[model samples]
Target: MRPQENYMVIISPGLLVQLMERTGDGRSVSVRELADAAGCHPSKIDALRNGRREKSTIDEALAIAKRLGVDLLVLWEHTGRTVPVPAEPPHIAAVPA
Candidate 1:
């Protein structure tokens, strides 16, 4: 199996927490601040940060990457290395099963 195929990769919760901690703007920012900037809800950010959520959409991930000032692909690569998400997109049918 290809490396991407064999490994299931995802961004770690700690990474998000670390990013939030590193913001260092003096004034405390709520999860909403980060999530809104990242185009998602505060709860979503909290979920991801606390490990209550497992996965996020590509758009959501991209938004977070943008807010973090990192390339989306690079973040994905890092997440893939650390979390090992599925290399290939899952197959889904238009028609309901």
Candidate 2:
């Protein structure tokens, strides 16, 4: 296999807490302030921060990244993707018998 083909950057969820903590250079931004800036609800931010929620939408993630003055991709851990997501997500075809 070609080396280039083997290179894949997979970004997972759950980096919100770190990003929030790092937003102010270790000072950390308030949930309300972050929520206002990132265009997401404070409760959602709290959820992510406290691990009440497992993941966040890409828009929210990008917003947090933008507010933090960092690249969104940096927030995610690089795990090699063994399976690629489809361009068009597959819809459930049936409930099964």
Candidate achieving the largest TM-score: 1
lDDT of 2 by residue, 9-91 (tens): 22433466666666646667778988888797898778656654534555666677678777867763322364442221134
Give the range of the ten consecutive residues with the poorest summed lDDT in model 1.
1-10
- Candidate 1: lDDT of 35? 89
Whole-structure CA lDDT of model 1: 0.60
* Candidate 2 clash pair list: none
Tens-digit per-residue lDDT, 4-64, candidate 1: 3232123577876776665434344568877897687787789778876645667677777
The reply for model 1, stretches above 4 Å from the true place, is 1-9, 23-29, 73-97
**What TM value does model 2 have?**
0.53
Superposing all C-alpha atoms, what RMSD in Å does each candidate have to the true structure?
7.0, 8.9
TM-score of each: 0.57, 0.53
The runs of at least 3 residues in candidate 2 whose Cα sits more than 4 Å from the true structure, single-residue gaps closed, are: 1-15, 24-27, 77-97
The C-alpha lDDT values of all candidates are 0.60, 0.57
